[model samples]
Target chain A: MLNIKDLKVSIEGKSILKGINLEVKPGEVHAIMGPNGSGKSTLSSVIAGREEYEVEDGSINFNNEDLLSLDPEERAHRGIFLSFQYPIEIPGVSVTNFIKTAINESRKAQGLDAMPASKMLKKMREKMRLLEMDQNFLSRSLNEGFSGGEKKRNEIFQMAMLEPKLAILDETDSGLDIDALRIVANGVNKLRTPENATIVITHYQRLLDYIVPDFVHVLYNGKIVKSGGKDLALELEDKGYDWVKKEADNLV
Target chain B: MEDLKEKLLSSFIAFESTLNGQAKSPIHKVRTKAIEVFEEKGFPTKRNEEWKYTNLKPILKHDYKLLSHPESEIEFKDVKRYFLHDTDTYKIVFVDGVFSSWMSRTTHDGYDICTFASAIEKYTHIVNKYFNKAASQEDSLTALNTAFAREGAFINVPDNTIVEKPIEVVFFSTNSDTEMMTMPRNLVVVGKNSQAQIIERHQSLHGNNVLTNVVTEIFAEESSHVSYYKVQNDEYTASLIDNTYVDQKEKSNCTVDTFSLGGKFTRNNLNFNLTGEHCECHLDGITIIEDDQLVDHHTRIDHKVPNCQSNELYKGIYDDKAKGVFNGMVMVHPDAQKTNAFQQNNNILLTDTASIDTKPQLEIYADDVKCSHGCTVGQLDDDALFYMRSRGIAEKEAKAMLMYAFSNDALKNVRIASLRSKLNLVFAKKLGVDLDFGL
Candidate 1:
């Protein structure tokens, strides 16, 4: 459902994603493992149409549409979702209100009417149950004073509600505890379908244990140097990123 | 002496002279003083200290035909539209500058609701005591308002009597093309241990280059509770200068909220004096200006006695070359020990050309007081906006979402639902932003 060819991106004229080439068909779970500043997050933001990253040379095709040509909101309406590394704290906007607006906007883009209030509430309650989120969480302001674990779980809740075709989890496991990681993984696992795809970007191999990836890619120095089955995640976890960098140097 | 010289000054030397003929014996003393102040410091030029940010060159170019009485009759339907919904309160309507006894309700047997003219004749001492006490001739706008003071409503709640409904005073300026000026003098006295809520609404119809100068004084006695809500919504060509003052006695509670959604070159001076022990006051204002509109708010809160508390918060959102200014001051007197005063002014500039000048000042003479003031002027939070946009909300909706959230802190303080909803609608429409969760 997603194709990225030689994605060369830069921010402020500094090279970030040097040459990223990746492909993920429907129902595939791909995991990208890299150390900090290895361009893992930059790749996710680029595919989700964050304006900060300037595409020096490359093309991204999502569902036969030019992903790079769309605005961030337009990308979202076209079934592309990005779970931010750091959730934003929007004060005075209730979680329910925010989620409802998001859902309605996406639906309207697809020429569909907004979900009725009763159905929307029911759907939200069901998603909250799937994520094990407290009912009071819906009434509070979005991410304001929320715990790290709660924020991650809320992101998963929103992901479930939107049901995007391609979901990009950008460091979703960065701040999660063991229980939160399990809840987040379980929620993602439940929403999987043969027509959808997910790209899990993380440094640790522990998250791969819950949502097992069909493929794993190691990113180093702004390039994907190695690609393999899910076992590569375990190898990287055991050897660390330094081993990968040394091997790439030896190969070059 | 300035005071003596003011008495000798003509109350009607300017373009409009009929005001001097209508000034009663009780109000003449102050009227003369106001004229002297106006002459000494004519309309403020750009060089004046207080009028530095705001330019009044447009008003000086025109000659205003002074209006002292109601020129045309206003129907009850029009007055009803200005009344607060779901409240059975007395309605006093003022057209041009004269009170409409025919349109006002006279069944208020429990409350002392009378016009300024009738009150001046019946309660001469009360009218003489409070009438120009709130606004002084030191201010050019205040002087201009006083030099042509005319008929307005006087509301006095008896001692220990709690008014269940809110008293509304509606001021309408209708159909005058030439430069016109109308001064509305309102005095609200909440007796010792009484409680009441008052709403003052100013609306204009069918005129360009018209001016409305209003002065409102609220005397809140010991342990009395009063909430004053002012809505300044009028024609884009109309200019308004409103001076509101509140004097809180021992243990009294007072709140004044000014919502400036629509106007052209509007300036508001709001002052809260916590004069007695353990008094509390809250002052909040929100102004949404766009399309070359200019709005200014100068607010001061004085803590005089020990254990008094005051909180002042004002926010402005401007777009499309609109200019906004907010100057807030919190003064804690030497004797006002343990005073807790907080002041905050926040502004959001939507367009690059839109501007806001905000200054929050806190003067603490008492060492034991806790006082802090802060001001922030910036665009919407980029991270918050991006987050909303990433969720499929359009750029405009995302901006509106954050803007409304920014204003929610001030709006939540309003306890009245009807007033809150109306204010929310006005804000949304003025900002050109729609609210998904409509009130």
Candidate 2:
């Protein structure tokens, strides 16, 4: 459902992602594991159409449509959702209202009528229940004064609300405790279907155990050097990214 | 420099002859002294410290005829949109400085909500006591309004009574002449242990060269609570100078909010005096101007007695070369021990050419007082803007939503429901969005 061919990306004249290729079919879960500054997050941001990055030479195709030419909101309307590592705090805008606007705007861009309020509320309630969130959480300002675990949980809640075709969770388990990690992984697992996909980006292999991935790729120095099945994550966790880095260096 | 002053000085006799029977009243004596003060000080120049940022030279060059009475009639349907139509209110409306009896809804059931022109003769003693008592005699603009003060609203809430409906005082200037000036003087006296709310607005029908100098004096007796709101959304050719003075007695609470949305040039002089102990005062203002409009707000709060508290907050958003100025001061007297006062001013410039000058001053003579003041001028937060846009909201809508959130704090404490909702709509309209929230 998504394809990236030799993606060469730079930011402010400094190359970050150099000649990276990746392809994902429908219903396949992929895990991109890397150490710090390996361009894992940058790849996700570029796919989500962040304006700061300059695509020096690359092409990104989503459902056979050129994704680079669209703005961030337009890409979002095409079912590209990025769960941020650090969710921003927007004061004075309630969580419910923010989600409502996002949903309606995306629908309007696709020539669809707005979702009925009753149906929206019902879906929101069910999703919040799945995430173990309180009823009052929907009324509070979007991410303002929210705890770390709550922010991560809220990101998953938004993922569920948007129901994107391809979701990218960038370090979703960074600041979460074990319980919050389990809740978030379980929520993601429940939403997986035969027609949707997820790209789990993490530094460690802790999140992959709950939401198992069909493919695991090791990103080193802005290039994916190793690709294997689920056992690759366990092998990398046992041995470290240093082995993979040395292998990549030898190949270079 | 002396041309406008000479014209005003020469026209005083002719204006006095119009008030035939009431020429020898106490108000006439006050008017005679006020005109003398205006003559001495004349109009303030840019050289003056208080008038350094605001220039009145361009407005003074026009030959503006001082309108004393109503010359044309205005239909209720034409101006009903300005009122708070959703709720019931005691409305005292004026057309060209004359009280529109057909358009006004005054009451005498519990307290007085009528015109000062009638109250000056009926409640002569009360009128004489608080007519110009709270206004500053030293300021030339207040003196100018006092010199030509003839018609405005007069509200008096009796002791231990709570006014059910809010009082709305609106002044609408019609485009009858090319250039016209009007002076409206308002007096509100809330008796002991009473509560009241007042909303004041000045608007013009058409874009004419109209200048308004209005003065309002409010007296809050012991334990009384009062809320006053001023809405200035006139046309581009309209200019206004508003002077409001408030006095709070022991245990009284008073709040004044000024919303300046549109105008060519507007100046507000708001002052509060806390004479008795344990009183609370709040001064809040929000200004949004575009084009070549200019809005200046000058406020002063005096904590004369011990254990009194005051809070002042003013926010402004300027765009398209508009200029805004804010000067707020909090003074604590030597005898006013254990006083608490806070003042803050925040501004956002939407364009590179738009600018804001803010000054917050605190003078505390009491050793045991807590006084603080802060001011800021900057653009919108880039991080916040990016964050909102990343969530599928367009850039323009996101910016508008963030601005609406930024202005929410200043309007949080508005006491009148209808007025608060009306201001919410106004803010939404100014931000160019149909907001789905209510105040």
Candidate 3:
């Protein structure tokens, strides 16, 4: 559903993602693993239409529409979601109210009426239960004084509510405990469908134990140097990223 | 004196000449001294340290009608929406500095909830003891208000008497002959163990320019409680210089909140004097102005006795070419040991042209006291804005959300739900958003 052809991106004339080529069809999970400063997040932000990244050359086409031409909210309305690695805190805005506003705005952009209060409440309650969130958590300020686990869980909760076609989980497993990781992966697995796709960007293979990906691509030095099946994750986890770096260096 | 100052000084003299027969009245001495102070100090200029950021030349250049002329009457229905109509309140409504007996609901039976004129005539003892006592004699604006303190709200809750209803003091400037000015002087004396809530507002019902120079003195006696709320939302032709002072006694608590949402020019001088032990003072304000509006909040809290605490937080959002100023001064006396005072001012400048000047002054004398003050002025967080927009909220809606959240922290202490919802609506309207956050 989403295609990228030789996507060369940079920020402030500094090269970040150098000539990237990737494509993903429906009902597929792609894992993009890289060490620090390997252009993993730059790729996700560029695809989600964060205006700071300048595309030197290439095109991002989603569902036959130019994704780069649309604004962030427009991209979101067209079923593209990016779960931020570090969700910003909005003090005095409650979690439930934030989600309610997000859902209503997306609906309004699609020329639909606002969801009824009762229906919205039911859906929220159901999703909160799926995420194992407490009922009292709905009234707290969005991400204000929340723990690391709670922030990631809230991001997943938003993804579940929006039901995006292309959802990018950027570093979702970085700050989670073992139990939180399992719960987050379990929630993602339950929401998967034959017509939707997800891109899980992680450094370790622990998350792959639950929501296993269909394809694993090793991203290094602003380029994807290797691509393999899910077993490659375990192999990289065993041999470490240093070995991959050496192999890529030898190729250059 | 400058032109406007000389005009005001002579105007006061002419008005004072008519009260010759009643010179022996109890308020005569106070009025005489107040006029002298006004003459000696004149009007504050930009040279003064406190008035450096706020210039009064433009707003004071108007030739105001201190004395009223015959004008059309205001209907109850036309002005009813301005009141907190959901609940019954003791309202002392004024139309261009004149007490409207028909529009007011006052009582002198159990408690003294009446006009300042009647209070000075009937309850001279209470008025003589508390009126102008807590306020400054050095401030020319306060002295000016005292000199013209013929109309205002006079609320007196006796010792151990908790007022059943909140008091509403409203000053409305309607269609006048020329540019009109009104001075509202309020004196609230909550006796020992007493409690009362008051909401003060100055509104202009017409497009004509109206300058309201108001002064309010509150006396919270031993162990008493009082909450004062100032709602300054009016036409762009209105300007206000509000001076409020509070004197707290042992074990007393006082809170003053000023919500400045609209006006052409506004300057708020809030001073809290904690003279007794175990006193608590809370000063919070929220200012949201667009266009060429200007609002300045200058607060001073004096911790004179031991074991006292004070908290002050003021937040603002300036859009367009609007300007804002916040000066929070906290002082701890030499003998006031174990005192705690905290002051914070946060502002968001929406556009590059919008500006804010914030300063926090902390003068700590006691060695063991704890005092801290901070100030911040910046634009809304880009990361937060992006996060909201990526969730399908448009750019305007997202900016509104972040701005509202940034300013709503100061509204956490608002006890009035009806007023809070109205404020939320005003915020939504000002921010150009379709959602009402009161829900």
Candidate 4:
């Protein structure tokens, strides 16, 4: 579903991601775990086509199309969604209207009419139920004065609504409590389908216990140094990243 | 002397000839003194402190054909859309420079809702008392308008009368061969314990290059409430210089909201004199200009008595090569104790070429008073842009949404629902958004 070849990224002439390659097929889930400043978020942002990240030398192919050549909105139209680490608080724009505009805009890009209001409302209610969000939450401004958990949950709610082909949850479990984490993980697990894929980017192994990943990769520095199954997450949690950091330092 | 200024002097002689030797009349004496002031001041240059950021030379160069009478034969159907047809309103409409009685819906049940021309002749005593009472004789532009202030809206509400329906005054200029000029002078007197709301607009139909130099004087009597909405939108070829003077009495409250949605070169000189104790005055404005358009707002609030309060908030969004200027001044006299005055001006420049000059000039003589002002200029947030773009919304639409949010606060105090919705449509259209956000 997604392919990256020799992905080298930098920002403001400072190299962040060195040569790296990854691939994900449909019907699979991949979890990228790393410590702070390990370029985990950068990878997700680069895949989402953030303009600030200069793709020094890389090619990100999504569903046989060159994603690097497309704008962020164009990539979004092609089912590439990046759940932000910190959501923006846009005042005066209700969440319902924001979602409606996003959905209609994506549909418009694909040459389709807007979804009827009734259908949109039904879909929204169903999605809200999946996330256990209240009905009034749809009318509030997007992320304005919202709790951290609510912001992350709202991200998942949008992901469910858009039903993106490749969903990258960048640090979605950071500011959530145990109960909120369970709910968020449950929401993500419910949205998982054989036709779509998920990449859970986190700093800990706690979230993996709820939405178990099919593959686990440890990203140290810029490149993925180790790859294993679900058990690898427990191994990293048991022993800290110091040993991994030593190994990566020696290798560099 | 400049050519236009020199031409105006000669034009004054021709204008006076039309008056049929009413030179000894008190209003005519006021006009004669105003013309002398216009001659003395000529036209404000960039050197003048108040007119620093605005350059009137380009507009002053035009040999304008001052329209004394409305010659355009306009039907009700042609201009019905301009009125607030959905809402119950008392309309005092003017076509060119003449009162369109056929298109207006005024009343004589209690209030003298009529034309300025008729009021000057019929209610000469009342006109003589209030005419040019609040407007500054020192302002060359206001003086120029006073010299030919024979037309426009004239509204007088007696004491203790509540004006139930909103009054809408619309001025439309039709397509003329030459670049025409229309000077509308409006007088609104809200009596003691009375309340009134007004919406004034200047529009041009299928024409370019019309200048409307308007002067409006409002008197809010003791314990009265007045809400005025100046909805200024016109073609890029149409320019406007609006001079509005407002005087508030004891315990009176007045609010003026100016929406400068579209125009070529616009200047708003809004002055409020808080003459009595415990008076409240509010000045809210929203200016969104694009292309090479320029809009300047020079507002002043004078707290002359004790216990007066004033607030001003002006928001502007400039795109392309558009320019804006906001010079808000608040003056508190020595005896005006406990005066609470606040002014805030926020702007967002959408392009590299777009710019604004904003300053808050406060002159306070009273030591025991609260006066604060703030101004901000910035572009759209980068993180906000990325967030919206990643949600499948394009960059342009995202910017428009941010602008709408920035300008939403300035529209919060619009009391008229239909007029507010109409402004919402105009605001959305200008920002190129597709939502009827009634904020």
- Candidate of highest DockQ: 3
Model 3, residue B317: distance off in Å is 0.4
lDDT of 4 by residue, A1-252 (tens): 899998999999999889778899997999999899989999999899789999989799999999999999999999989999999999988899889989988999999999888899999999999889999999999999999999999999999999899999999999999999999999999998899999999999999999899999988889998889999999999998888888889987
- Lowest summed-lDDT stretch of 10 residues in model 1 chain B? B1-10
Best by lDDT: 4
Where model 1 places Cα greater than 4 Å from the true spot, the runs are B1-26, B73-80, B106-108, B435-439
Identify the superior model by TM-score, candidate 2 or candidate 4. 2
Instruction: Give per-residue CA lDDT, model 2, range B1-439, as digits (tens).
Output: 3477788888888899999988998899999999999999999999998889999888888778774666567899999889997889999999888889898999998999999989988899899989999999899989988998778999989899999888999998886566778889999999999999999999888777888889999999999999999988889998999999999999999999999998899999999999999999999899989999999999999889999999999999998999999989888999999999999999999999998888898898889988889999999887666655556777787788778877776887798777887788888899876575331
Interface quality of candidate 2 as DockQ: 0.50
DockQ values of all predictions: 0.74, 0.50, 0.74, 0.53
Stretches of candidate 3 exceeding 4 Å from the true structure: B436-439
- Order the candidate numbers by TM-score, best to worst: 3, 2, 1, 4
- Per-residue alpha-carbon lDDT of candidate 3 for residues B1-439, written as tens digits (9 for 90 to 100): 2477777778887887877675767687888889899989988899999999999978888877778543568999999988996888889988888889899899986789998888877888888888889999889899988887777899999999999687889988885567887788898999999999999988888888888899999999999989888998888999999999999999999999999999999999999999999999999999999899999999999999999999999999998999999988898989899998989998888889988989899998999988888988888888888898898888888887887777777778878787777777777778776764333
TM-score of each: 0.95, 0.96, 0.98, 0.94
Worst 10 residues of 2 chain B by lDDT: B430-439
B321-439 in candidate 1: lDDT tens per residue? 99998888888888999999988888989899999988788888999988888988988887787788888988888888788777767787677778888777767775556565542
